[model samples]
Target: MEMQRIMEFPDRIMDKRPRKKPRLTWDMHPPPQPQPPIPPPKVLPTTYHNQEVVNGVAPNHAYPSLFFRGLTRNGSPPWRPDDKDGHYVFAVGDSLTPRYRIIGKMGEGTFGQVLECFDNEKKEAVAIKVVRSINKYREAAMIEIDVLMRLARHDINGARCVQIRNWFDYRNHICIVFEKLGPSLYDFLRKNSYRSFPIDLVREFGRQLLESVAFMHDLCLIHTDLKPENILLVSSEFIKVPDYKFLSRAMKDGSYFKNLPKSSAIKLIDFGSTTFQHQDHSYVVSTRHYRAPEVILGIGWNYPCDLWSVGCILVELCSGEALFQTHENLEHLAMMERVLGPLPPHMIVRADRRADKYFRRGTRLGWPDSSTSRESMRAVWKLHRLPNLIMQHVDHSAGDLIDLLQRLLRYDPAERIKAKEALRHPFFSRDPKRHGYPL
Candidate 1:
């Protein structure tokens, strides 16, 4: 028993060896203590080369070079290259076809930019619409040109449409020349703080608009996009627009006009969306606020569509806001019901399939059950609020104006008054002794 405990020890215990600890090396030095993150490089402030004060403030950072490239040392027109990339670059002082000298940008639109220019040959100021050099815009511009050309051939004395002086292709763009005009009716409204135009003014505008629209319809052309913005004053004397920026600032101020002019000559402009009477147009042609019910119902529309738009325009002139003030089709339909009474059952039944979602089945006049529909119903119930609203902004003697609006705004296109007939409406035939013959 004393022969030592080693005699009985297992062979596995003798074979086992002691483990050794891992040694630390320079390569494994705790990832170099994660050296403090290097600070980011500071961005230098951008300095504009032609920086100058404009309206007592620094020029727009987006267009600092706009002033430097478009003027000569003596502040005169300067010629620039005609082409940029695949499009035309119309500079402030560029020569267009050696006939007109660019003065400045008058305004811009979906099809093109209108430039105020001096017609060197004609010895008068004119407007040149430089259409964007794209296929769709070019096609639209050509259609406008064709319409204007046809219009010019008529040469009726009282035609209230703009005349196209000339048109030619330059640098892949269709450049159309027109008589220089004043601000738009929309601008006039803006200058007047969105206040309703005087009753006399409203009548005169309505007459002019009717005359123009009637003339267009007679010629089998429909102005699909008629609005305040497309109606322009015939003279700049009424509103002095020194430059686009000045006009913009004046519009923003809302006090541009201290007193309303007794009258201003207006001409219908922008025929890019005009169509032939026989053509089937897209339902979404007119501006949403002024769109006709027939168009909204997806039923076929005709010349009467323009009459509906005229009603809307007249309402805006008298109320300082859109008659329907809605974009959604259902809400628009609801507002129409509130103001004009529910659409006729025949109209609702014959409407495009899309309209069923707005109407209740088997009901002569019922809106859907929804939050918006309920709110619209409540609005209809409280429509008495409109009397005070109308009185506050509209200084017009109501007289036969309401009747004329109703005739023009009827849901049935056939029931809508024709432009020629509207010209003879009692609204326009007010007693000369009382209203002074509305210009």
Candidate 2:
């Protein structure tokens, strides 16, 4: 389907370019966890958003015991002491409000937990993102609400992104209600044991993804986080396809079969990090694996950064793994050079002051000489180039996809393919039937 431009803005002003700052390493941040029940001697404060938790109590102020998990990991669960963290402690069958009842938990993240609730008033299921009570998260939630409202106003049909049903402030937590949808692409891949999708399926997914991205870009908005986890299928129904490899290895029950989504329709979610094209384009954005080269280099990024992320997501969908799996900036850049070839000389020339160290002399990236260990060097060297990597997993349709991916993964943002242009590429234009690929 074509992406209908909802609204258009006159030429954008890229005025605020932030100065170079120290690179923020990809630290595996955990959810807002409270301290253990008992306090030890000389307890220090764990500060966040000016709210300090000293021995589970705010400095001088006693922490409220308002957090409860709906379900526990233990097989048969029971109500336990609620947590004192900022998270809104909830339980199954508990009422979020006069109209919504918590049926189950959808998921949890750094921000807070998502609960699957039955909207008694609407007589339907909905997923509600319950934001933490901390001031920062609440502020971010407001931004997401504004962005969703803007998109909903422009996207009359709600074709490209998730639809927000409703939202409210309960106990200081910003609760956002959304239409219930299927598992994220990342969840599906993991449940399928990281099996790569059929080339035909990948094409369908790629087409829709670019279209959604185009829709966002047309509105002058950028979805900083576009990983598979943020892309949810419209339906959970699927068909089981034979997995001969699993059968060969030793199958049990339905292990020899893999589930394939019956439909490719998707909706993009997670707009908390979404930014306006004219906003400050300096701070780092996007997840570690899908981050653009310019972001890691501390160079200013714009809409093209989303395109780069789309490129990475497509690669992960095809290969059953992330394109570049590293947390450190130097190693991440080194791996990029290994897969997509060297960084563009001009890009290297314009590297941010803090990111300049990753590149040495001129455009050459210091890798083997600067690697922390032989294993790290080996990991970078083991990566196959763009075409080779595509050919490894995809047959009968590698040429068009390779050409398309190369353009999308181009080191220079200017040279990278835009979402609208990428939708017109042969990779999406061609018929799979003529190529003899599975449906």
Candidate 3:
């Protein structure tokens, strides 16, 4: 469906020009197939006004526990693997406690499985993320609880965090309740088959995401994994129209909003990589593709690492493809240089010391002149030969997005622009008319 009302603002205070979408043209491609008119997912009533409705029912069977499977892996099946259906199959009727009822399985990960569930009291469909690996589940559950609690307490510009309906800790499992937003950003991009992202939509998504990260930064928390997979849409309606006036005021003054509605806002998930502060801290941790240079090199880093991930997220969102995806350390560095220009002249002491030992196998061992040259870096980036991918999905040339991306992905943590500053760059603040999306 066409976006009903694109956010528009009348303010024209800035003389800056909106960054142009690259002039490059190509073979015209048709829009995606008509997505079957599936009804949007049900929305539960919040403490906010104008609540949306949802539809779904709970299953009558019990959800089988993974405890027995874990035991079997160590030896033989703890119980009979034979059931009436076949070689023992589980159903959803098992998890009917008080507030939650298992409906069906939504997805699974290394530590846990997510179930499409029904919140009995709220009468709303929800996604219940149950940690099956009981031992490893604690860490995930703790992080999820902390992040959700923090978001529930804080207020920010046109941004929304997840709401914890309730949480339960079974003897062998921990189930955290959350309002089930439909699909994740990863799912959306995949459905599109990685092509033709709307420029305005990406900017809008980026702005909201940064605002959320900024809020987390203030709380001294870092979302180590800020990729599309960890970002879930709250509702299609919530993100369509941004509050331009509210966001403008926030940029001008570091103010916060009260009783914010989380309509189209994104709910950050998967804090498995999140690190909390110690009395005195040092070192780094985060995922590979979206990881900041300092973190990758094993140097000390803080919240800014999340901003770096945010930068990568913006590129991916706009292009519907990953920007830096090399698996090898040297190759990854080369890709970074191609997109970000170069590594800084000065390196973090910890990172440098580690690189001296770990990075010795390749030309990266050489300092400055001994290292990979600029031409080689460009060649490595070109080797991917992703021009059509960039043009078709990103709506811009690699160079154009690179210019904007460099500000957020800088090697020097200090040099990396703050979220607020990045939002004001010509990319967003350039045009107050068409580009001035409502907050």
Q: Arrange candidates by TM-score, highest first: which order? A: 2, 1, 3
Write one digit per residue (lDDT tens) for candidate 2, span 394-429. Answer: 876799999999888888888899999999998898
Best by lDDT: 2
Quick one: best TM-score, which candidate? Answer: 2
Q: Candidate 1: which stretches are off by over 4 Å?
A: 1-87, 239-257, 362-396, 432-439
**Winner by TM-score between candidate 2 and candidate 1:** 2
TM-score of 3: 0.65
In candidate 1, the residue pairs with backbone N, CA or C atoms under 3 Å apart (3 or more residues apart, or in different chains) clash, namely none
Q: Model 1 over residues 321-365: C-alpha lDDT tens digits?
A: 666665577777777776777688888778787766667774344
List candidate 3 segments past 4 Å from native.
1-90, 155-159, 236-264, 278-284, 348-353, 357-403, 431-439
What TM-score goes with each of the models? Answer: 0.72, 0.80, 0.65
Model 3 residue 95 lDDT?
34
Candidate models: Cα lDDT each: 0.65, 0.74, 0.54
> Could you tell me the TM-score of candidate 1?
0.72
Clashes of 1: 0
Prediction 1 global C-alpha lDDT:
0.65
